[model samples]
Target: MDDQRRIFLATASRLGALAALTSASATGRAQNRDGGHAYPFSLGVASGSPLPDAVIIWTRILHDPLNAAATPRLAFSVRWEMAEDEQFRRIVAKGAASAAPELAHSVHVDVTGLRPDRWYWYRFMLGDAVSPVGRTRTVPAASGMPKQLKLAVASCQHWEFGTYAAHRHIAAAAPDLVAFLGDYIYEWGPYQLRHPKSAVRASESFTLADYRARYAQYKTDANLQAAHHAAPWIVTWDDHEVANDYGNEQDERLDPRFLQRRAAAYQAFYEHMPLRLTPRDFAHLRIYQRYDWGKLARFHVLDDRQYRADLACPPPGRGGSNSVQPRTCPALTDLGRGMLGREQEQWLAQGLSSSPARWNILAQQTLMAQNSQLPVVKEGDGRFWTDGWDGYPAARRKLMDTLHTSRASNPLVLSGDVHSFFACELARNPSRPASPDNPLLATEFCGTSITSPSRPQTRTEQYVSMNHGIKYGRSDKRGYMLLTITPSDTSAHFLVLDNVHDDASPIARAAAFVVRDGRAGPVRA
Candidate 1:
């Protein structure tokens, strides 16, 4: 057997053993195609960008995802079906989707006219070969009220770091919605701890083809495939999706050719994702939009990287991750600088004011609460990470003011960029202390990465010490967050694995917090 085949079989065996741990059945079971061993659906399938009436079903027809040596330059006719039953007894929607080569033969079936708040199973077929069955569901009607909502927040699954044990856990949880807040695919080439039989490109991804190859490599993992096939997802990109710590049109490496690279990356991202909207131009790719789960919650998805001003503290082209005092950096306090741009900020403000849901959620890419990295003893005075909301103080203040003024109830923020779990309270007055007049404005739950390595453990003294708003924080292990929302309360559980390197790693809940109706902060539960 070829080395790649051997490695794939070994990983498949490990995943099969771990499959017993999950309650939900796994997807992406390989099928024999033709007399010859032709693997057409190698990347598996995904469904995302859901709505009350519409949901997208996606699959890429790739005979060779990792090695695109020879281009067939031919389009394939792919048939798709949506069923009300897992056994495919009653079919709801069935149609033929063309997998065009121009778009990498990726089929995105925008299934519409479906009933709200309903579950359905979907799958694809090419010739006599059948793809894995994927499960999907539509959100509740805009004016309707859902009694309960289960959302799994995940991010930063670096392929080289470890296996996607966390994603396996997410699939088993079977959340109604999965929110992926960026770093969906790492642009850099594979490094230490590359999985066995895993194909790693030698050079970093830059061109459209290079980025496509990287995505294919990551999608080959059965565990990740299971997670994607298990539920419908809402996705947004972070820095690693294009370039590390890239701001607006600026690249961290200070490369003049970065915009070309950015364009290619954006195109590839759109092609691979199950997005309803296609990119008109690489410079104008839009992913920020809103979704409502009936009257239960209104999710305002924001893009913080696309049209934002550059980093503040060290300034552009300085190549630093250190924090700075507000006095030291004049630009850090600039009110004109923005993270979500003016247009998106206005849209968010309008959404918050006009939202009719019981819970208002800001589902975005990065942390919104101010987090101090300084010593615990220096409580009120310290430096902070420039990459997060702390660098855009004025912008964050504007959001806080909007949330405080809006009529939206149980305002909450879900974030997943820092690769650390944080349960924090957004203060009404960000620049000042929290008091009765300026008390906790909203609750923020920042989930850790799906498989990304944890940051260096901070001193125990830092927990709930330096930052008055930080109710809990942990950077020791890799995991995801499970959020259960209802009319009366919203609860968040931090789920972690004992070891990600082991496919059968045990899953455990490290901590959990609850925010009751009318409460503005998270209380330990």
Candidate 2:
């Protein structure tokens, strides 16, 4: 059946749509009864660097990958084994856990007391058969620095856009951690696909089940799974995970209440992610968190939604995305007009001011530098852009000022979103600089999207030209970025995928940037 037809049928019967998720076939049980095989393992194991020492290991138990009659609801004791050597000659940590079908049989065990600044291999076991062996590592103790650190970032991966060829490239780089900047899944319409048959979106995800199904589908992709199995991943969410342009308390569309949708999104995000759940009573918050990667760098991963005020628009739109009377929005400078609520801001500020790490990296989303407003659009964009930090001038300024005054060493802002890629020297005022020596305290590198379609150089040139702050830009490609930080200089290379249209495609280097130590900005080389 076609994608649109699938949607028409699924929406026609909501309960039937759900029943299919739990459907089982008879061929599955017969093989299981007679085959006398070991347990089945499908979802491979993964780890996250939400903290040092502690690593979250995850797996999903399955009855069988080939059997249709096998139920996905089987509860099983998922066992984990971590070894020091790739040969498994020396085992370090061993643990056991259980996941019932009610929870999708997914398990996450936070393993502690492992060696830091070290590489480890792990596998999930059921009975006789074992899962695909995955590799993971822990951040060294604070004040400990690796001679080098390799990390990759990416966002906006719509299955319909193309294959995860970028993921294949990331796996080859052999990064210590994959810092996923969000939009791991796109809630796109099925009609958006040019290769319609490959990607089929039958339902709009709103409830927890829908969200989980979305994650499960993405998890099934070979490239995405390969990357996850290749290294521990650090993840955060962006608007598309819920709805596009849905920021703070505002929803651009009139379809769903922001908070209700947020709760569902968060629950599903945590369940599929390698995140250690922080059990809360009734209140829900997933906006802010920090990670210390040894003493080399401290990552302050933040949420710019939940607490943001309404948007600033000269004219209003259909929903709340970016509309005027956004004055209908509260005062953005209202101290309460927080993108990061007071509590999160305070936490971030304290972390920045007191961080002893050599590099304090702000691993967040959105373009931090100043973006052009008008005539520039006519020149290059062919359309005006006001979706991200550009829409919230006040919030952007506050964060910039905080960075300018802080003493953190080599403070660099790593961001995504804008679909397009932007590398800029973030100044107190990009249109004009106040001081040369203190050209402004930091640098901002905005990576491009995973599979989201972006404008070409023809469309982005004029915008970059008009916007004095932007040093470089490209919206034509879908790929990820490899940020290599060393004691001498922090270098970032945009790892562009040769093509995502083909499944077997390989990636190649597109560009590179080196922000030397003591240098306040990034210079393309």
Candidate 3:
């Protein structure tokens, strides 16, 4: 036997009687008659970070997902296989990874040496238990130009509010990639508030175990799992992943122990994701990165939560977001304040300046276009929401300047977390309508949350009317955005669920917009 296979066998032998009880059929599906242990792959399998010749496939060996203490302390050998076909007959790559209890027994296998721009099926095995098979594909080679790209963008799934019917539909669409723009799991839960009989946790997650259990509970949802299994995902976090409206090291409550809580949450996030980088000290995780879809598109996925300044002019003793009149709040105009921090801002500028792709996609959390609560007919009439881009006007202006000066080709910003679908023309000053002097610089399609509730539709209408650049806004529905990108143009479809309370709810296109090549704004399609 080869050294790798021999080593894998030696490690598998450590499972002792359990490994001996393992058996498989012709398709490599584990058939374990062993009744001594609970199933290990209850959380399902996923793949992400698709490079030209590599993708990260992940799974966690959880006997009792709700309780991290149930996992044994010993290291376990996990076997993974990738094939060109659903059946294992054409296995292209196979490897073994060690799932230690330190990372909650999670396995992240960065499989490489595969052909680019091709679909593959992968699964994980831990002794007698086998994970669900997942479908993934690598991006086209860096220099190669592809004709089209289909992408599904989604975010803000609060487990208690509604069902993940949107994710179910996303899986059905089978987009080339899934970009999760954050709030994968809310930091707190009152299970009885919405779904009275639900078994999810009823408190906030503050420790490592709590965070892990929360993630486990969310993963139990089959629709979300199906979405993960359908395509390679690119993910970034928003506030809810740690605490609602949290910025930098401060939570809404301004607890002195907030950083410790954040560390636990960050570690849990890393453990559950199929990411390329590992967290440093469980406190800092550099999630902002770039991905190229051949020469067709360049995705600049960003992290806006970790390094942002705290919400300007928060209520006394509170550190989270609030609504404030920019004219009255002097701190709102701080030129030094930034939403993406200094380093990330520079990196983004550099990327935008150097990218040669036909489309430049800024996949981020929350809306980028300015949305004032009141009409901006005069200087002091506008009321801005402190949680989004309006909170950092200087930074937003800087980003818009970069897009303009860099002359980034067909710049498109995809955002979420507001729980509303918004189509807007990004301009130097979004308060006023686009014109010859202050022209549109890019297009933005901010999708609604998967299940999170939104403000009333009437209020959304008012905001749309007040924000001249916003071509469309809808807060009544909950869903995701589907993007079809080509050399000539990019189309966005706002797909909404009829009933988020029902897991099998039907979905429909609520709106559609198209941005043609070399154009700066989206027009109704």
Candidate 4:
């Protein structure tokens, strides 16, 4: 095997042993596509970005490359079926697609003509062998407004983090949709010890192959695939997908000479994920888009790193992963400042105004809160604005104002990154003195990292006490947040995972929060 492929496989095998020690995600069965085991399912089929009649189904043809070194690109004629019953005796849609070697033998068949807002089960068959069964569904078609919407917003699932305990818990709950806000993969040194993989992928992935190989390793995780198999996902990236704290058109780890890695990462991101392939390639990368869930929600997904200014503090630094909570100050106003550039902002503003969706959801990867430590602590208290909206105060204010002026029926911001859980009320005019009338224009729920370590709760509580604007905070848990929305009310199900490495983890509680329509703020339940 080539060095790259060997590393990827060896890493999975090595970590597989340790990963079993703590992860509930690995509990399904000793079935992997590696061929040494029964290899029960082909990473189970998944569908995402649902439309009235179409949902994209994805699966990879896994073969024993070790037995046939030349067959790294596994190929097979695969058949998929979506049915109203567990048995295909009552099939709704069926089709044939070839998982060709050029695409790493992965299949992305966009299936159309299915009922909307209804349940369906699906699976893939390769020859006489069938894959694991998974369930997925579409949203209400346009003009239809259903009552409740359940979405699970998650991010930062590092591979070695004890078996995707968070993913298993999410699957058990069976949310309607999963919004993966970012940090889907960490592309750096010092990967968490919890990662089951033996050694990490290249620390600086700058080529299409590097990115693809990285994703292949991540997708091999049973817990991750289960989450995908269980429900369609709404994914948006925050650093780590490409590189840490990366801003638009910049490199976090690459030297000036190796910037071409960006194209590599972008293209690989496309090939591995369930995302569709297009003939067009912007320097060999594909990302950035939005999705709407009927009138109940209109999700405006943003790529924070695609177009951002580098972090300002500790000068001459690339923004990513540096000081997950960076330094703050004058650098916050650099003219190059921007979280979401002009075009994106305008598009979002336009979408917010034109769309009739009752809820305007900005699904992003950073904190929108303007927090500056009072009686300022050390040089970098992780408050530096360069890494997030704080880096561009003017731009953040504009976005906040647009939501305020548009009077979006209910504006809610869901984000990942910052590695903790935060619930806050956004003030269009935070500058205004605290008053009942200084109405909060929007609500923000920052989900904790899916598996990333949060700063200890003790320190976080101390910081929260000092920073009043931060309504609540918790930094020492490896879990995700669940969001339940209704036309008249939106509540967050802050689902907590007991142990990331445990074989049978339990979800602690569904900490609830409610936002009354038009009131524009979340109240603790």
Overall local distance difference test of candidate 2: 0.68
* Per-candidate local distance difference test: 0.80, 0.68, 0.86, 0.67
**How do the residues 203-304 of candidate 4 rate in per-residue lDDT, one tens digit apiece?**
555556556556655665656766776678877777777776666666555357435666666655555566644735645343556677888888888776
Better of 1 and 2 by TM-score: 1
Model 2 bad stretches (over 4 Å): 1-40, 62-74, 189-202, 279-283, 314-317, 323-336, 373-384
**lDDT, candidate 2, 284-332, per-residue tens:** 6564678888777888888776666665452444444442222333442
Q: Give me the candidate number with maximum lDDT.
A: 3
Worst 10 residues of 2 by lDDT: 18-27
Point out where model 3 deviates above 4 Å: 1-31, 190-201
Candidate 1 ranges with C-alpha deviation above 4 Å: 1-32, 191-202, 315-321, 375-380, 460-463
On TM-score, the stronger of 2 and 4 is 2
Residues 1-525, candidate 1: write the lDDT tens digits.
Answer: 963354334334445643432212112233345544345677778898889888999998876655654336688889999998767999999999988877878888899989888888888988877777777899998888788999999999888677888887777777888999999999876632235344455568888888888887777676787778777988889888888788887776767787888888988888888888865787678888888899999999889988888887555555424478765777777889899988898888899899999999988888887776664343245676777888788888888888878867889999988888989889855544578887888999999887776666665237447677777888888889999999999999999989877776878999999999998888899
Candidate 2: the clashing residue pairs are 25-69, 143-295, 248-305, 252-321, 325-328, 326-329
Query: Which candidate would rank higher by lDDT, 3 or 4?
Result: 3
TM-score of each: 0.91, 0.85, 0.92, 0.84
Better of 2 and 3 by lDDT: 3
Order candidates by lDDT, high to low. Answer: 3, 1, 2, 4
